[model samples]
Target chain A: METLFYDYVVPCVCAFLACVGFTLMFNIHGMGKLIAGVGGALSWLVYLLAGSTIFAAFLAAVAIGVFAEIMSRVRLCPVTGYVLVALLPLVPGGGIYYAMRHCVAGETQRFLSTLLHTFGMAAALAVGAMLASSVFRAMFPRLRRTGKG
Target chain B: MDYDKLLNMAAELGYQLMYSGAEIYRVEESARRLLYAYGLENPEVFAIPNCVIVSVDTPEGHPITRMRRVPPHGTDIELLERCNGLCRRLCAAPPPIEEAQALIAALPEDEPRYSPRGVLLGYGVAPAFFAPLFGGGLADLVSAFLCGSAVGVCLLYGGRFIGANGFFRTAVSSALASLLAMALVAVGVGESVDVVTISTLMVLVPGVALTNAMREIMAGDTFSGLSRTADAILVASAIALGAAAGQALGGFF
Candidate 1:
């Protein structure tokens, strides 16, 4: 129970707060900010529930992308705002930090391995987000009609 | 309708979209739609990262082209959404050229949506919460909050002077934040300096660039996608380099 509280509940709350911060920093306004925060919280919740792995990060990113799309449609805002803020918690900052630390300490092998891992993680996130957005685009043909007149 | 004014307005719209960090295809699509709604036959719109080019054939069988060099600004989602809504409204109604011009000129200037104090609070709170997500403990959370506030101060103030040079601003702020985190750990304030540093820097990472780059590639804009990918890599490397420099300096002190 303690583990669940620490691992899932705490992070979810933090993620929600962090997402709100990002919404403010990114200059998102109105109720869209709250929806963006929910998008971030949802992503973090999925990430924690899916366990710790590269695949988990990918799935979480996909969840974020899809949620952002829904929010964009509902709120009439750009997806760029919500999607970017929501994915902030999953960015490979820790991996990049460790990679740089290894390089500074002259641990070439460790640096290389860490850098590769970071690259893979970033790639997974990118692919997942791309897939989700692409699916959204395909599903909503009317949304693409920017030339109504 | 004067073709010159119409072309100018369309190009200006594209510039606004690009400046707000909209995707390249989106910019091009918006420009093309605006021109088409304004009675331009077969308007050709091409938007790169830094420039937008639009061309349309006149009644005299001559092609008139207008280009605008849009200076990139920080992502302002409010402005992007407003401009997008304007485009959609224009498309649906095909407003007169004069009305369209007024609408474009009336677009809101970029402004911070929150007060300075609120922004600072957000900066501190975000990293404080992110610390635990990245495996930091209670002590690390407090340390990260402090370090993140320092970064927030640097961004709020240093940005006024160094806002023009994005690379230098990012590097300097990131290095200073990492240095503060390291000092806190050295003073027995945090359990792991690495976790604190990582969590604090999360706000500055290039997650949006990476995701946009992939989406651009999937949308068949390969050149833009590749360039965006390179940009993301460069920014990531800059943050890493700054953190390493900070660690070296901290070790010396």
Candidate 2:
């Protein structure tokens, strides 16, 4: 239980709070803020459950995409804010930092590896979220139109 | 109906959408749909990342094109939702051009905005929480909060001093965050320099650009997508470079 709390619950709560902070900076008003925060927690939880690999980030992005789409449909707002904010935790800041440290320390081999991994993680996230959003939209076209209406 | 007025209005709407960081296709599609609602059959609408162009015929074989250059902008979801809503309403009813224009003009005025203090609180709170995600303990979280707040002050209030260049500004903020994190850790306030620095750097990451770039590519706007992809890479490099400079500066301690 302690392990689960440390590994899953704490991180997701942090993610949720972090995304709420982002919503303020992005000026997401009204119900959109809560939706974005929940999306963030959901994505982080998914990422943790999927084992925190590049593929995990991909799965997390897919989760965020679908969740954001559903939230947008329910709220009748655009999905941009939720997806963007929720995906922040998975954007490879650590990879970039490690890469920079390696580069600065003259470890060219390590730097290159870290840089490529960072790129891979980012690509995985973008592609995953986009694919999920597109599939969701295709699957529920009439529903989306009704929501838009 | 004055075609010239209509042309300007549609182009202006597109401009507002782009400024609010709507996707490329959304801008083009919204303008095109608005023109269609106004009974124009062949309106040509095109938008790149920084520019929007709309052309319409005045029913007498005369063509009028209006192009607006969008300035560099941060994403404003409130404004974007408002623009989307107004666009839909305009398309639904084909409001009088002047009235629509008035509505569009009113968008930025009455939209919600957080106070500067609140935005600063956001900048601090996000990194503070991010530190825990990065394996920081309570001390590191407080350290990250301070570093994040200092960088936030630099970004929110030091625009003129930092220069208007996005790359330079990001670099400066990253450097400040890292340097402050290192200073705090050195002074025994933080457990891990790595955790606080990385946490502070999270706010400066190019996640928005990356996601928007992918969305553009998925929507078949390869031009905008490529440009945004390049932007994301640039900002990432800027953060990397800036953090390195700050760490190097902190290495003296």
Candidate 3:
């Protein structure tokens, strides 16, 4: 129970709150902001459930993109506003830091590997978001036709 | 509407979207759609990180063009959403040119939803939660909270002097944050400095830029994609550089 709480529940809540903070920092408003926070939590939940791998980040970002698309349709806002903040927790901050630190410490091999890993994670996130968004864009011709989105 | 004014207004709209961090395709499409709705049949719109260009063939067969150099501004999703909403509404029922111009001019002045204090509180508390997610314990959480607050204060103040230079602001704030986190760990106030540092630095990371860069590339805007990717790389390197410098300085102290 403790492990579950610490490992999942707490982190998910933190991710949600952190995304809320991010949305505020970016000056996001209204129902979209609240939903964006939920998207953040959901993405983090997906990340955790997928075993927190680079692939997990990709899958989580796709989930976030899909959620943001639905929210965009419902809230009548751009998906950029929602997806930008929601994907924060899965970004490769640690990987980039370690890669740079390794480079600075003269560990060339470790630096290369970490740098590549960070790049891969970033690529995964981007590809996932794009795929989901494009899929939704294709699926929702009605929304586009009405010019409501 | 006069062709020059219409072209100018369309470009202005694109500039606003770009300034608010809308993706390249969105900016281009919004400008194009708005132009088409307003009776400019052959509108050409192009946008990048730093500039937007709109050109349309006038009734006289001459091309009227307008361009705006958008200064870098922080992302404000509310403003982007509002502007997008404005575009949709205008497209649905084309507004008068004067009304459209007024709306475009009014976009930047929209007030933020959260007070400064609320934003600061977010900055302070977010990293505390982030620490646990990064495998931090109780002590790391507390330290991350403190460090994140310091980062927030730095941002609130440093942001003013730094202006729109994202690279310098990120480097300065990240270095100070890393130093503070390292000092806390050195004094045994935090368990793992790595977790605390990473959590605190999460706010400054360029995840959005990187993600958007890929999306742009996949959408066939290769130039914009590459430019945004370079930007993300530069920001990441700046943070990494700042943290390294802080660690080296901390060792000396």
Q: What is the TM-score of chain A alone in each candidate?
A: 0.90, 0.94, 0.93
Residue B132 displacement in candidate 1 (angstroms)? 1.4
Q: Which stretches of model 1 miss by more than 4 angstroms? A: A143-149, B110-112, B160-163
Cα-based lDDT for every prediction: 0.84, 0.91, 0.85
> Candidate 1 vs candidate 2: which has greater DockQ?
1
Candidate ordering by TM-score (highest first): 2, 3, 1
Q: Residue by residue across B10-72, what tens digits does model 3's lDDT show?
A: 888899888888888889999999988987777998887888988899778888778899886
- Measured by lDDT, the strongest candidate is 2
The estimated TM-scores of all candidates read: 0.94, 0.98, 0.94
Model 2 captures what fraction of native contacts? 0.72
Off by over 4 Å in 3: B159-164
User: What does candidate 2's lDDT look like per residue over B1-253, in tens digits?
Assistant: 8888888889989999999999999899899988888899899999999999999988799988999999999999998999998888888787788998899888899997999999999999999999888889999889988988998899999998988899999999999988998899989999899999999999999999999999999999999999999999999999999999998898897
lDDT of 2: 0.91
Fnat measured on candidate 1: 0.78
Off by over 4 Å in 2: A144-149
Backbone clashes in each candidate structure, one number apiece? Answer: 0, 0, 0
Structure candidate 2, residue pairs in collision: none
* Per-residue lDDT value at B132 in model 2: 88
In candidate 2, how many Å is residue B50 off?
A: 0.4
